[model samples]
Target: KIKNWLSAPDSSRNMNEAYGKLQDGTCSWFFEGEQFSTWKEEPSFLWVKGKGKFLLVSLSSIIHNVDLAKQDSSLSMAYFFFDGRDSQTELQLHHKLIRSLIWQLSYREDHKVPLPLVNLYKKYGHQQPLDRVLRDRSFRWIALQIEELKKCASKNEIQKKLGKLPRGLDETYQRILKGIDRDYWDDTKIFLQFLAFSKRPLKVDELAEVITVDLGSEEGPAFIEDKQYQDPRIVLTRCSSLFLLLYLLNKTSGIIKLSHFSVKEYLLSPMLTKELFMSDAAFTNWVQLWNIDLNIWDQKRSRDKTDVMKMASALYYASLAGIKPTVELLLTNKAEVNAQGGWWGNALQAASAECHRDIVELLLVNKADVNAQGGDYGNALQAASFHGHRDIVELLLQNKAEVNAQGGYHGNALQAASARGYKYNVELLLINEAAVNAEGGYHGNALQAASAEGHRDIVELLLQNKAEVNAQGGEYGNALQAASFHGHRDIVELLLQNKAEVNAQGGEYQNALQAASAGGHRNIVELLLQNKAEVNAQGGYYGNALQAASTGGHRDIVELLLQNKAEVNAQGGYYGNALKAASHWGHRDIVELLLQNKADVNAQGGEYGNALQAASFHGHRDIVELLLVNKAEVNAQGGEYGNALQAASAEGHMDIMELLQEKDAINEDHKEEFSTE
Candidate 1:
């Protein structure tokens, strides 16, 4: 429970896994380097800088040496591998570094949790379960504060360069590319494209198998028996600098990966513009041929489901890329034209979305389901409509595509066309009876979609077509609130003129006034207020206009809300009240203003419980001092981390923690004196 509560990343486990794969004498040359000796002797930083194929393996050896030195000694050691492939959160990447280091230092020897950690756990453990409470607010707050530390660490670092090495990785990669044998150049290009454009890292055998099959042959994707390498490892030897073991999964069966992400970047980039990498047209042709051939090969190998998926994916991509020849070839090879896969679903939808007129015609000729609903924009018509592909929309409509079909991101063709401000597409869809008052998708109805995007012409067109102006749904509820929130003053006024409800509460920001205030649209706020908008309407992400304005650091908007009788002591939203929101976000002027307006300094609700705790947790020392001076309750406890001290402790905000401690001690002394009196 405690270990889980600590929330240290499992990078130590990753380190161990990599370390276990390290060969005994690998990177032995690094140990003999002068800078390595200096690093071992000194407390100062020594960066082992290189663009070598074996950098990861070398680092593993160094970590192993560090671990060996720490054995049976008082020395503490911690190491973490930063894998760029993993989508680590800001808290996990930055703050977890500090947490993991502290956890390691405190508990590495004999696995005992330090007294401070235990005290922290005990302090908040009673409020909720150890895991939930530890993570609730503390991690995010600490992560934000540690951003400065990350920036500082990035500054003025010394890097030890290897002697006689190429100054940059690009230069090294260039030389390696040039060094590939002339005989193997064509094969190597095919080998690299398979790696570069592959969905995931291909295994060594898989790569070899693909390379053995010749797609450009007159016989069509024939296997060259003599060209096959006996051992899978020999395939890697042909591409020297590009084939280092990129973190093996086990001893025998290793999953192959690019030497580095930069290798792929270099291959795809224009800097290496040579015969090594094919042009867009050539690459598309290659890919189309390869996909078709690979599918047949996979089918022969008895992997029918996987092969069909691959074929469908290829057809979708070929259509999407607007490659006529590729699409024709794919279809010729019996690629499923109506295959339900990829972002835009079928080949027809993909081609339509990208405005590939010829391909759309080709697909329709092949009897693709014109109204097929499955992808990002639902049907081919919706996809074409959303992307402003008028020609494709016309084509789909001519072929009996459904205009009022509701499914995708923008709901239907009408809504999609409206959101994108495609007037012609909107008109075309409307002409085809697209259900003008359609309600669904990201923006609910066409009017609100148009209004949200500030498409006034579309808004007018919709209204003129008797589109429901007050129809509620989508991100901003009604058109008026959407217009007001987006700061489209003209649209807001127009919607108001159309009798669109000003205080119509629904969607993300609840109503126009609060949305306008949150977005810092003072003119819109003023306009809404003039049109009888409710000043104290609550129910958005922020409780009310005043809280929203304060949270957004909109001083002018905050002042306007205050003048309009906005509540200062309102208890709702992420931070409970305007004061706490302002404090947490480091809006000192707004904090001061809220305090002046008699906002509760000891208000206990929201994420950090009180204004002082919110400020303390986020490292707002000035706000903490100001709140303390304004007589914020020092002992108040009930939100994320119990009290201000605990909040400060969670983030290691020493200055705020000390200030809180002094105030708590002073309050205790005063209590004692009062009791005696």
Candidate 2:
């Protein structure tokens, strides 16, 4: 089945089939003696020797190794493919498009390189076209330009012969140089260069002498310090770190030759990246015949104590060293693959928790628990979801990791994903059929979690996927209250639009309106009001919406509630009137708004004494004056405010006393002294 991309005229885009159909059909520069044929397009792309079905493409000298000599100059990038367009543009844009291709293949640990875009024709721009049509089909030109730049020959000298540069080079190479100058993570070229030297011996031989001739070693640091030593290779060598490795290789030829030999035998070995230096399995096997303990998984431990901590540490160090340690090494005789540890986790737990899909795979292959929960991570899958490790989550799900296992931070992976707004992991879990409404630990269900965190997109996704909008609240995850509290106007709009219970209340906080009022979110209060959220629905520690808003000192919220007909003198909470409550906290705006809304001047709050006294006690002189101007009682005894004089004296408000004097208020009738300091 030939794809459309294979029919494209762009050589870089249609390389595979086009090159495959070539008369010679030989890329001696790459797979010297390889042949290609066909097989049934089933479920795999496993290329076999002498089979015309499987074919590979070389991505050509990705980096210039003329400078970085310490590290073996890795030349040549390779991958397999079935499409012809991948071959077409691939040929033309092969050199310059290296940066774009590397990014398209984000080679994180577990999700191995997409060798198909290189080798497999599966997702090649074979059929459905995308917006990005790669232009700078001149990676080789960029390489040339970089070489010319290294010469430091002045512009006229440099531009003496070569024609105009490609547009992409003009715009991008300078930028890439700027980044390399700043030490960014653009090492694919360097990495590919390293791969090149390590694989092809002839290529290695061609570059070795030029790169390894370190004249700087003789003059030490000052040798290359000469104005004559100003080579662009010097800069690239310093940046790419090839010079150091080459220097080391030259300094210690024995180690280099041995490691190089090992590379020849196992160029693609994951073990090489790790400390598991089994030079060769055959060689090691022969030595082991002598009863050698080739156990790389050695660690001191208590007999019954599985050192998950130590195992994690080893795995961590291995990854940093580009090592791929397996569960076989992790779970020796009785290392206990499922052993639990402290807060962090057990073996399976830690892998899942850290979203270390590779480690998790090794453990699961060796029988690590997937559903088992009792560590920092709720479960293996849950841990992956928490960290937004989508690939790891997919791996776990493929291996039958549970979708709704609970008992971690928010309970399950779904809720965890929702809490973090991990769109990819959330989608992965959902695609794997994660329960949307299933409660996770104490955080209710996925809907509640996404709503609480104001993750509108996730909430909309959940709602679209049919999560019950009113799935009863959890211990602390009250979806409606949470939306109201954070003033998440859009989330509130979404929930209400989706028929979420406006007056819903039954968790740590009660009712949407009260929560909104307490949170001082005027817009959310308005949305709830629009949705018919009860003006008096009460629950949380603060009681009704009026009291909640008044106590919260939310002047705007108070006015909106009043405009929505919230009772001003409504006696609620330990403090009675909203006016007295706001006044007690010196919230002058809320106090004045309440007064303007016709709140009673003498509305004696059970704990607040009266508006004037409450204002005086909190040293809200502005509030005291507003109340007095509104004809509030001058003296109100008992409760937190004590008496008017006592409250004013406590706050040291001489102006309040003078205001009382100006009002011809009698201090002889009532008197009380109080001291806090």
Candidate 2 lDDT tens digits, 102-142: 43333322335446544545655455645455332365445
Task: Report lDDT per candidate.
Answer: 0.73, 0.54
Q: Top TM-score: which candidate number?
A: 1
TM-score of each: 0.63, 0.49
Clashes found in each candidate (C-alpha, N, C closer than 3 A): 0, 55
Clash pairs detected, candidate 1: none
Q: Which predicted model would earn the best lDDT?
A: 1
Specify the poorest-scoring 10-residue window by lDDT in model 2: 61-70
Q: What ranges in model 1 sit over 4 Å off?
A: 1-178, 181-189, 192-209, 212-237, 240-313, 665-677
